[model samples]
Target: MLKEFYPYEYARNVFAIDYKKLAQMGYTGLIFDVDNTLVHHGDDSTPKVDSFFAWLHKLGFKTILLSDNEKSRVERFNKNIRTQYICDAGKPDPKGFLKAVELLGEPKDKVVCIGDQIVTDIKGANNAGLASILVHFIRLPGEKHIGKRRYIEYFVMWTWKHRRKYRHRLGDILRSGK
Candidate 1:
């Protein structure tokens, strides 16, 4: 499933993505997950995400935020980001991704869906016939309510370990201040 493919294996968080690099790879559109992706789950407000969105636009990669959370939550987060978004995305189902493609008028071959959770992001993207990425969630301190999800995520990552060979290789360049 998730472990057999390289595209599903080596994804870092949406923000850490190299849009220019992706453009080189012929990807022209991006779909992102919110919450711990663009901001801490508890924060509600997106921080520093504006700059990244701006950069994505300049690089010619249209972005869309997709989340299973309610419409209000997605709408609130999209306020300052200036990007299209879908709420109650029911991710892992391919509906949201399909909707996004329709909205962007872009083909699956030129689209890459980026998110943190494998069950949600990867599966949804794969089902939609789009390239997928599973990125580690942002680390925050003293957060609660993520209790069982951590275990579930661990299991996914455990399975995902099989594709480590194709995982994100830009780690060095990304951390080197690129």
Candidate 2:
């Protein structure tokens, strides 16, 4: 049961991810969480994000935004990045993740999901049989429900960091295909 929440890889944030190496690993698709993963809650895309998306494209990745946010929020954030997206996605349910995989036309094993929350993003990707990359939230959300989830995420991350198995797993992921 506890294993269901465990992410396949963990990183500080999206910028820290080694996309080039992932490409070499035969990963062809990337599904990203919009809110805290790409930017702070309710914020628009930054120059860094713009460049990163371009870089992903140049590297031949099929990228898509899979967010739980409403269409307005997702649309606003996507104005500059301009990737395909599914708004108001019911994550932690695998449906959204599966849809994302279908959108990329990539096999389950060739796709990766990147997000800041385990309860939703990580679990959803795992349920969809995709590799999940757990990134720390760029900034904590101000919403009551999301803020509450942040606390639980902190505890889970704390425990995850303390475990020897997780340490080895993290090391392996970082060194994979290098």
Candidate 3:
């Protein structure tokens, strides 16, 4: 059902997330998708990304990079950030998400997964019983040729946006810092 694809929160970008609020909400562990969630596909970590991880560490949150890409790709992006990482994660399967929870040593109720895709990220989180935050995906050049999955995702997103109960008021969290 579409409920499985619903994210607990939605943010425009990783940088736009209100981590303080998430921490206050008792989310001590963060599982993040690399491509399109933290940076463009196949891109290295930006200085901003590095700083963000540093900030998260300072806030006492355990973080990990979870990617469907191969080990080399995940390693390259995580080189500077140095968070724990799991590659070839086989997402939307729940196994990887559960593995991340184990690796973080955090309770399921205290962890969250953040990613750009509903099919992989949100569904996997839901299946694993972890909270999820969805970020708009970064588009690649020649994106139209990528696949038809984006179209389906767009339809799902439209439906999600129209449902107020499923939407998280992230703006208020960002503004009030609560």
Best by lDDT: 3
Residue 95 lDDT in candidate 1: 83
Clash totals in order: 0, 0, 0
- Pairs that collide in candidate 2 are none
- Model 3 off-target regions past 4 Å? 140-146, 169-178
TM-score of each model, paired residue for residue: 0.82, 0.87, 0.91
**lDDT of each residue in 36-75, candidate 1, tens digit only:** 7778664555456877788788888888888899888888
Angstrom error of the Cα, residue 144, model 3: value is 6.3
- Candidate 3 contains a number of clashing pairs equal to 0
The whole-model lDDT of each prediction reads 0.71, 0.85, 0.88
Estimate the lDDT of model 3: 0.88
Cα lDDT over the full model 1: 0.71
Looking at candidate 1, the ten consecutive residues that score lowest on lDDT are 169-178
Off by over 4 Å in 1: 1-7, 164-178
Predictions ranked by lDDT, top down? 3, 2, 1
Error of 1 at 77 (Å): 0.8
